[model samples]
Target: MAPSATAHPLRGREQGNLPEDVSSFVGRSFEVKETRRLLSESRLVTLTGLGGVGKTRLALRVARDAQRTFTDGTWFVDLSELHDADQLAQAVASTLGLQDWSVRSPQSVLIDHLADRRTLLLLDNCEHLVGPVAALVQTLLRACLGLSVLATSREPLGIGGETVVRVPPLTVSAEPARAPAPADVPGGDAVALFEQRARAAVPGFRLTAENSATVARICARLEGLPLPIELAAARLRALSVDQLLERLDDRLRLLTRGDRTTPSRQQTLRLCIDWSYDLCTDREQRLWARLSVFAGSVALDAIEGVVADDGVDGDLLDVVTSLVDKSILIREEVDAAVRYRMLDTLREYGRQRLRDEGDPIALRRRHRDWYEDLVLRAQRDWIGSRQVERVSKLESEQSNLREAMEFCLGDPPSAASAMRIAAGLYEFWIVRGRFKEGRNWLDRALADGGPPTVERGEAMCVDSVLAALQQDTPAATVSAEEARQVAGRRLGPGRADTGDAAAVARR
Candidate 1:
């Protein structure tokens, strides 16, 4: 319900160009109502959240619903593909069907045209050129009393009097305790969204008891985010729910299908995260790649220790803060300690960048070194009054420790470090009932056949202990004998190999 661009006989047909919704709008009734309320109270309302969180869709929906309030009509301008800030005003002007050939600036033209109209302008995807967009919006609002602007951005435009409404991912139901009939399932908005898209992708697809739980798992795994859910649902045309859920570990590659009419950046999960990545500064991008070494939420101290380097030149805190503002990094306060994390999709994208453009080996080695240091410190303090704190720290960093150990084991030269780390965690593994996991790491590291060293000897001894605990006497005896032989020889220095140079992509 947008005003027509054709000049009305009285005031020219309501002058607006809001695109029609191609697909059904999913649930966000609360968000829609809140955004509309803010629109009424303020001249400027910005919808902000992570990319692909349905800001544009919600904005468009609200615009359509509130069109009757604006006698002059509602207009939508998409800035996703517009990279040049210089063309920001021109883009809005062109979208409004402006045909002025005069030398006056587009801002002047827009101000003159909208001065007397009770118009609603919906600016979609304004995060990239937020500064320029903010300046323009301020100018237009000051010149036009009746104009109201609703913008969608990953971050807020920091202009005075701007109201920010964060659009969170759709609410998703917890895993059902028991599978029920489709009608009995109380799947939330995320399930409803997936069902709708899945039906379109595969005709007659229904939420039967057999697949309902899998569907719920799929939505939960996707964190109830809409774009990922939609992309995942599309795979139902070619994959079963179980298959789709199993393949979601590599979601960036698996969810590559999308509508052809949409922008290329939005056509896949990787590309969507890639769009956000591209908006970051060079240093910020480097930090993003380095931070990918983490498995889950990370404290600021951990990031500073592992990610800060001469390659990423800047105040690490500032860069981290910038990423948070841009929605590339999510900040949280857990137990009164600040931490940050990237979305799984964003982490995958950063990992790909690290492999393809950045020095993956160096960054990962630094990551390993940091975690290794933590493990060593924890071992030294395990027998004291801080034993509980040590245990808590080790438990919290378990995933990071695993990632570091995996990296060391994979790289031949770092096999000794891997053995050392595994040996150091022997008590932790035993206490945590991770006997099999400890043995697995030791086996992989010993299989690398590195030079005789105390580290390797320790690893073999620990492997023997774990094997004996598991009642594998044969393997335990072999490891114990190997440990004795390794201890008898002098350790040699490891040779380092240069990693291959990765080609950088031109911006």
Candidate 2:
């Protein structure tokens, strides 16, 4: 196939079917430029990402931006509405304004109609019909010179020479260097998008000095994904920023207002994730749900440790890579370790599946066990020159650790595990100045009533020291006495370490 420039120019007005976007378009300036460059070189360019990361919008905007360049026409065919692969070619033919009456196939009609015309077809939502779409695109490009196809899907079309652009979430400021002024708002596409939709939902809504940080927080929590941000911003008509943040824990339920004109699968945050979720293989589906056990970006080993089980059988890395290919997981390189993460929206959706199909409690317990082993390893490493590295690792794994600890505390048999984990990380708590948080976990674990094992004694010792650090001397004294009694009973009659534990607690 030749570049769009070499095709014959049509006599009539350019025959195009690109739809006009009713709402505003935000971000993807770089994506638009790169896509246009690729379209100039390749017959097919696919924009792939999670369902609501704005692939369709970016494809449309890019098509519109490059339409004038295609003299014959630029057209859009939304395959999202077409269910069967058999109906795919018909959909394309109709989009191209061709009505076939002869014995020729729709595919033949499309090829013959655009044989010499310089045309671009923007095919949206191809994941559901990847095989048919790939075949159609491959056939059309081979037969019709000067034809280009831009496709959007949850994964790549996997055809030879297909230029795949993985669309990313909108930009978010992870941490502001300082307090941001109104000037900073425009640069963060995620915040800018939130502000735009908020204004639409509530006429006077604006990101103010007081709420700018909150708005950024909201975006960060949503991982800067566009659909969630749009749904969140729309809630401003009824909920404040603080309220929205509070309700984000159940975001799938909270973020239900999608544009009425959009396909029904995109009508809510849950439906958007559901559409993607349904496309996965059984192993992929089970792994996706189990991976919700992670707190943030997960190292490959961590994923294997947590997700590999009897029911979910496969090479863990292959399953994970498949998820990445399907845009369910985002792979990140942090330090020297490769990690993968899901957007919170997807994570919540997966967590719900974990609850439905499998044992969330068992999975969470496994999650807790993995983190417990991790903390112990970090504790050993912290005593050496790798202390800084260990600290950074601890910080990175903080969310997962917290999740694990919470899991342990919530289950009776796991209280001992929580106590052991809390006791093992006393050094981390003290160095990081998280005495109160450590104390709270320790207190709750002890309150849950585990046996007076050595782990419990150690936890009591750490709790006493934490109480002392918080200036609660009476509570410190009481805890110190309890620690001494438990240690003496558990560790034998005259262990000097028991005295040391009590003295450290008092001091």
Candidate 3:
């Protein structure tokens, strides 16, 4: 447990405002230390991360720890409840316990009060109030030489000379090859937080050899998010560890029991997400739900093709930027291309919204069609100088392509396109050394009850090639003969390329 602001009252020595932390603060020693170090070197330090990752808690802890550094004392102000930009200065002034009898503006009063004072202002939840916060921060820094601010938000305020630190989820242990020792169980920060919260909830809860593994699994599944872990730990009052794991896939419902003493928005996992969701514009929300279509990370072009639809009207890139800013989507660079992914929990939330507002089947069809075209383009580019580039792109989209294949093989099959896509990636499989998996997908699509057609011939050709690579001569021979028969039926022995493909497979 950390010392609350109430425990250390503001007396004659210190002259600023800070709140008492009601709940026990969990792991984040490194984040707190690094944040303080950053604040010392930079006038403005912003802690940025997705909701429920504990940016506010970490910011408070850092401010509390750095009380002695500022001669005028450290101040804490939460901006989540503040909505009006016009009242932003009043909020800050009120938090600092400032009394102004003069007719000066609130912003001016704040600057004048802190003009010669060395102090820290810790601002929490600034994403919704970025414009006003940025303007105020810039103005204060230029006017007051002794003022420093440590702020937390989903994104940076982007003020000049502001140092931004991205707060990552707590570290979890890697999946063990065998049952790990109880001593090693507490090594991970996420598991530590879970255990601490669990003990507090159940009073006598213990992390022995029996439940350590399952507890670690829960921590990892929650992606080391502090709030969800705490909520999940609270449920252990009734549910067993294994039962908790079973229900975690639908985590928004599973982790609803949060700290009752906290704010309404902080009382449940869904509400935390709702808070962030409500802050987004209509276009940003629509794009967020639509992006749930991706099975894994996707490039900018894929997002544009899939997300820019009727009812959702905005520049696709701009909407994506907004999502990234609000921490709904995570951006990463893969193979020199920018790709974005939603956390599994966030993706599930977006998927529910997508199903509610739009037709999931229609969206899936479009997704399948786009992936089919992607395979065909990769096939075309595989023979050119861009072969390496194409291979990388296909590798990144492999999960999405698999999703497309599953959609195609769904009841009432779209077998023709399925077979075509599976077969089109034949070169990709061979070049990327995934022949076995490719052959398995091709086998499934070929048997999916499509009428014999040119695509079947193409699939047979691909299957024959993969069979040859594995040195399965009998299977290769069978596939080659099938290709020849299909080619003969579809092209009447007139297609030279089909005949050549059949001959190569037979050899």
As a TM-score, model 1 comes out at 0.49
Estimate, for each residue in 1-507, the C-alpha lDDT of model 3 and write its tens digit: 111111112134356666556356766878888888888899999999877788877888898888888888798876754555766886677557554422346788788878888989998889999999999999999999999999989889998999999998888868621234344455487887888778766888877778888888887766687867766776676689888887664444435444333323333456546545665788877888888888768888887776667457767888887676555776787556788877655777888998888568877878888899998977876787888788768867866887788778773557887888899988777654445557767888887545558889889888887776665657777888888777777667755255434555556
**C-alpha RMSD between model 3 and the true structure:** 25.4
List CA RMSD, all candidates. Answer: 26.8, 27.5, 25.4
lDDT agreement with native, every candidate: 0.74, 0.74, 0.74
Taking the tens digit of each residue's C-alpha lDDT, what string does model 1 give over 162-202?
Answer: 99998888887786423444443477778878887888778
Q: What lDDT is reached at residue 65 by model 3?
A: 88
How well does candidate 2 match the true structure in TM-score terms? 0.50
List runs of model 2 lying over 4 Å from the truth.
1-271, 491-497
